[model samples]
Target: MIKVDPDFITFEGIFAMLLSIKSKTSCGPDNIPNVFLRRYAESLARFLVEIFRSSLSQGIVPKDWLIARVVPVFKKGDNAIVTNYRPISLTVSCCKLMEHIISNYILNFLDERNILSPFQHGFRKGLSTTTQLITSIHSFSAVIDKSGQTDVVFIDFSKAFDRISHSKLIFKLNLLGLPSTIVNWIKSYLHSRVQFVDINGSHSDFLPVNSGVPQGSVLGPLLS
Candidate 1:
C-alpha cells in the first residue's frame, strides 16, 4: 500500500470520502446505492466513525464489509472457458473509503519516518515510469561510453504482491515500531475475506480468500 500520513479521520474527512463516491456506481452485495449514501453523507459519516472506532478497539470487522462481489471478466482466448477470465473483486464503497483514509495515514506516517528510499519510483510522486526509464538509459549510456559493454537483466515482480504472507507483513509492520493498535487494525483488515464469483448473472457460493490483497480496493495497491 502507498502509505500516507493523515491525521485522525474527522467528520469532514468522512464526509469528503462519501462525497467522492460516484453517484452511478453499482452497489456492492449489500445493495447500498451510491446516490443514497451521498444523500445522507453526514449521518452516514457519523455512523461510520462509530463503526470504525469499534472495529479498531475490538479488532473485529463487520462481516458485510469483508464480503466481496467477484466478477470474472474475459481477457482473451476462448470466451466459453473459465480459464480465459480474470476475477475482480468489488468491495463495499464504504469499506473502500475507510481503506483510503487509512492509506493516507499510513503514507503520512511512512513519509515522516523516511521509510521509503528516494530512489524508489513505482507509486511515488514526482517519479513517473518515463522518468525512471530515461534515468536508466542515461546510466547505461554512460557505462557504454566508458567500457563499451553492458549487461542488464530485467525481473518482473507482478506476482510477488499476490504471494505475500500476512504473517510476514505483520512482522514487518512490527519491525517498523508502529503502535500495536495500528498493526492489529491492518491485520484485521486482511483477515476473513470472502468473495463470490458471478458468471452469467449466477453467483457461486462465497469462497474464503486466505491470501493476497483484494485488488481494486484502495488499500490493495498500498498494502502491496
Candidate 2:
C-alpha cells in the first residue's frame, strides 16, 4: 500500500489542471465556458483547491455539479425516429477540473504500484492505436513466416459506455481493491444526476439519470 500525501490538491496542481482545459469547449447548463474558467484560472485555483480537497475528504460531490445537459445527435438512420439519435451529456467544466486532478492521482498511484498491465495499449502514455496496429501486424507476419497460419478475433460492443451496470462497476472497483474513499466518491458522483435533453432548441423536462457516467466527463472513460 502506497502512503500518499493527504494534501495532494495544491494550488499549483489546480492551476496546472485548469491550464489543461481547452478554451473553446462547449459549456454545460451552467453556461460557464472553459474560456471563462481559464480567464480567471489564476484566481480560481486557490478556491478550487479548497473545494476539491473538501470534496475528497467528505466524499460528497456538490449536487449542482452533478447536473448535465444531454444533447441528442442524429445517428445515420431517420432523424424523425428517436432511436436514430444518441444522447451525449455536456457536463460543467469547473466540475471537470476536480475530475481531472482525481483521475491524475488515481492513474499515478496505479502506475507507481504497477497495477496496470504492460500489454494494455489503449488510452495509455507513449502508445497509440497506430502503434498497436503496427506491432500486431509485425507479430502476425513473424508468426506466419515461422509456421503457416495466423488467426485474429475482434469483439466490438455497441454503446458499451451507456450500457454499463452501475452496481457491476462498483463491484469490480471494490474487487480491484480501489480505495474506499474513491469508491464512495464515485458513488456520490454517479447517483442522483439529472439531465435535460435538448431537442430543436427546446428542452425536455429534467429526468433522473440513474445509469452511466456523464458522457464527456474526464472520469467517464475511467469508470466505463
Candidate 3:
C-alpha cells in the first residue's frame, strides 16, 4: 500500500514515480519525453517533489500539464469512418508522476474504506472481464442445476469513455466523501484541459476539452 502524506510530496515518491515511467512512451505537447525524466530521475526528484507539493497546496496543476497531444487510433471497422477511431492522449510526463501519486493515495483510501463495490471488476487489480465472466457462469450454472431459467444480457456502448460528464463525476466523488483538497485538485485537473490532434508531422489547433477525462490519463479510469 502507498503511504499518503496528504500535505507534502516526498522526494522518494517522486523519484520512484519518475523511474517507473516507460522510456518508449510518447511525450505530450510539452515534448518533455519520458526517457528524459527516467534517465535523470535522481537529479529531478527533489525539484518535482517541490513542484508537486506546491501544486497540492494550491489545488492547481501547471498549465503545461493541462495540454495534451491526441493521436487517433483505428479500432477495427472502417478506418475512414471517424467514429471508428479513438483518441489516445499523451500528457506531460512529470504531471503524470504527480497524478500517479495522488491516484495511489486515493485508491488506498477507497480500499481501506470499502468505497468500491465488490461487483466492480474493471480498472481494478487482480480482476478483469474473465473474472466477471466466471462469476456470472457460476451463478447461471447454479440456477440451471436448480431447474430454473437463466438470462444474461451484454451491453456495449460506443464512445463510452468520451461521454462521461465532468460535473457528475465530481458530484459522485464528493458523495463518496473524498477529502475536499483531493476533490478540488481533481476538479482543477479535469476542467480547462486542452488537446491538439497530432497526425504524422502535422499538429492541429488546440481545442478546449470540456468533458470526459483524457484517454491516457492516470486518473481516467478511476474518474470514469
Assess each prediction's global lDDT (C-alpha) against the native: 0.77, 0.79, 0.83
Candidate 2 has which clashing residue pairs, if any? none
Error of 3 at 156 (Å): 2.4
Tens-digit lDDT track of model 3 for 103-153? 887787788899889988877778899998899889899999999998767
Root-mean-square deviation of Cα positions for candidate 3 versus the true structure, in angstroms: 3.0
lDDT of 2 by residue, 1-224 (tens): 22234387799988877777788787888988788778888999988888888887777889998888888878797788887887788887767877876677777767787988876667666777888898888989999898968888899877777788888888987777777777777888888889898766799898988787777677887777
Backbone clashes, candidate 3: 0
Identify the runs in model 3 with alpha carbons over 4 angstroms from their true place: 1-5, 144-148
lDDT of 3: 0.83
CA deviation > 4 Å runs, candidate 2: 1-6
lDDT of 2 at 8: 78
TM-score of 1: 0.81
Q: What is the C-alpha RMSD of each candidate to the true structure, in Å?
A: 3.8, 2.2, 3.0
Model 1, range 145-188, lDDT digits (tens) per residue? 89878888888775554577888888998887766767777898
What TM-score, to 2 decimals, does candidate 2 have?
Answer: 0.89
